[model samples]
Target: MNDNAATGEKINQQARAWYVRLGSEQAGADDWHDFTVWLEADPKHIDAYDRVELALLDISPQETKSGVLNNPVGKPEENPSDKIIVLQEKRRLLKPIPRSYLAGIAATFIAALALLFSANIFQSPANIQHYATNIGEYENIVLSDGTRINLNTNTKLSVQMGKKIRAVTLYSGEAYFDIAQDTKRGFIVNVKDTIITDIGTAFSVNFYESTLSVSVAHGIVDMQSPVQKVRLTKGQKAVRLSGAKTMTIASVEIDNISTWRDGVLVFENAPLSSIVPELNRYFKTSIVLMDEQTAALTFSGVLNISDQDKMINSIEALLPVRVMDDGRQILLSGKQ
Candidate 1:
């Protein structure tokens, strides 16, 4: 093995020894101090700790509680031979088992690497990629299972695909999923801890991190959480808290949610306080309203995102306010 690989193997072996010592309360104070000192000595020490933590977590629960390593010493402490016997027996039993587990992890890592290195992985007829737009940027992506995804503004996602299954993880963002229907194989998108399994549905998922908001534009989407699963129809909305696994269903007005897809934002009975942040996201400009009273007032109207001047005029028209522009910053207040 190479030097780095050899070092890693040695660390893994030491970790098991440390774990046993920790379990039996046999690790001396000096040993614990030394380990801590080494851990803080280099960044690689932290990485090694993370790997060992993963392996420990992956170990079978039965193996952990089996009391296999009752003593770090080979035998009972009455004599020197006891320590030798215990040490020898422990090494023999643990060496083979940990190597086997490491081999399995190596195999999975190799397979993933091969798939990534292959030139035709994305070009295959069976695989489709999906992409989406950012704030002021557009994208088109084809998924590994032939699904297309278009995302919009401040989105996050994870992708999983192979011959058998295709999955995407969307934590907080908006995405347009153009699912390619396959009877034998299905595509799924994960939102937080929930899953949106396609039932031949072409739809869009808009998720907000701070608020529990899920707006569905078209098709029947299956949303599954830890406690419950629900099928959402077109023009239906799901809202819940950030930590909540379940969603509350509501009938949504399609225009309000879908308008953002068309470069228009409409605020009906929306507080000026709420509107400022929305405007900040759509435009490169920063908007500040000096009057808290005016910011609290609710405004109802549609604003085409393309025409900033017109949009500003419309907002000012409704409120007794004046807009002053200073570079990219705009201040709105009571007419003065």
Candidate 2:
């Protein structure tokens, strides 16, 4: 109401914009450094930053929408920076949010907002958001455009919700896409060295430790990389290996690999080495074999995806092995 309050509000708004921009991968090193310097330069900067941070601390991320945050003008334009490129790199390192925790995030956020306003120390910013998931969690989210995404654990993604060109970057981990049919706008998911273009289809991309895998369930996906480019149909999967010139394509038993989406773990002749990643992914457990011989053995079985114990039990049953849980790690060894 007063000029000072109004001025503070304006500065707060600008600070919020900077925070959201920083969330973008397009935000350059110089820009981020400058922004950080500027923030630390003034008291208003700290106040504004704290306000925005408090607002988003509990708010979970939503699915990416087409033209969601690029611009509100509803027009096609060039990407001014390497945001997409940075996003691709981030996606390769992130995973999805868990369903159990996401259910409470909204309520927690609303409460936090109310408390912030009651204190009246800082005004919350609505447009900017920062989302993250811990280990062993996953979530399905709906974006503004009605597009849906199933986020995996230990993932960080930021969405710049706008009227045109909705954009999202996977900061880490894996995800499954059931992109909303937006033929006019199209939905795109970026990973390191590859871009996934879709229109109303179900697909899963796993980017971990520099390895990227893309699997299509229903409909089609155009996977483009610097080395290889191809269109994938249902029941198809492609993996991009580090420093490899060619991407490996295989006709996969879809149900076995993708059953995680349905809470089922189906292993159709999948090797022990191949299953390690999936086990590490589903449970917040670290499994290391003491001997290379144990690592080389193959596994074949179907375990309930939702139950980590059952899956591990199945693993122990099939192999002569010893399992140890140290709370921080799970080690498997050959006993028989």
Candidate 3:
């Protein structure tokens, strides 16, 4: 690529990063300071930022018909001579702009935004709010719809509330939901091909190793796909294996289930393979099985997460396995 083309591309990327960061509630005074410094670095930087602002506005532009209504045909207004902060503030930007200047910036940013979308550097939908729990972490989230969600370790999801329905797309991992009762509006969770619709319920859904499991503790839930539908009620569980045509429903002891809300993990004849992956979510280091034979071994137990070492020892005692801790990674092999 030519030097100017490469340079413009880099500027656009940097500007987009700054734009996203600044929009977050986590952006603090230091972030704002760094952003202002970056904004003042070069003239091309200003152009790049303007493009970012314009693209963000374009992301949701129903109310502000920014093209024809805001920017009309005219000579570009002269830059203010008195260092006015209202129109072009150092900290708060893109509030008020000269019509002609805004038109030029919007045109340029639209081109850059198209490139960004095509390259896949930006994928967040305008209306969706994203939440995630890092490995070894758990969080309680309250959505705009007044629904409560307990996100387990290594989980990521997005929420979008509408007038008629509340939708969430679980990208990965697990969560327990205390969905608010709304007869006029229903709650839905989209996991792979399965669409979980709630009927005023509290439940948990887990997506692991391409398999989806839904457990209803209270009320009823319907897991629907294009081919089949399964209804689950209190103390009931359903599993949809990857590429399966229908879900298998079973019964669980709701009172004894070790849910994330209580910080307990209950395994019912869970294989070493499944247990190891779940354990990794609560610890910084991972436990790796030495072979597939070790992974196939099954054990049933309730693990208290307060002490991870105790749980590891319990696993080792139940199965004929030895725990080899290497500080960074844990290794499990058959006991001699």
TM-score of 3: 0.59
Off by over 4 Å in 2: 1-130, 160-164
Candidate 1 to native Cα RMSD, angstroms = 27.5
TM-score of each: 0.54, 0.58, 0.59
Task: Return the top candidate by TM-score.
Answer: 3
Instruction: State which candidate, 1 or 2, has the greater TM-score.
Output: 2
By lDDT rank, best first, the candidates go 3, 2, 1
Candidate 3 lDDT tens digits, 89-167: 1122113334655565555446544533343333335556676655555667787668998777666777767656677
lDDT of each: 0.60, 0.63, 0.70
| Lowest summed lDDT window (length 10), candidate 2 | 78-87
Global local distance difference test of model 3:
0.70
Give the number of the best model, judged by lDDT.
3
User: For candidate 1, lDDT tens digit of each residue in 1-336?
Assistant: 999899887776766665666556567888888778767777777677777778755222110122222221122222211111111211221122244445554554465445333423544633433323334333346655577776554455555564555667665556778788877656777665556777776677766533445566667777765556788888888765555435799988876764555556777899877777666554456677677787778888776554567678878787888889988678888775
How far out, in Å, is residue 158 in model 2?
3.5
Alpha-carbon runs more than 4 Å astray in model 1: 1-134, 140-148
What's the ranking of the predictions by TM-score, best on top?
3, 2, 1
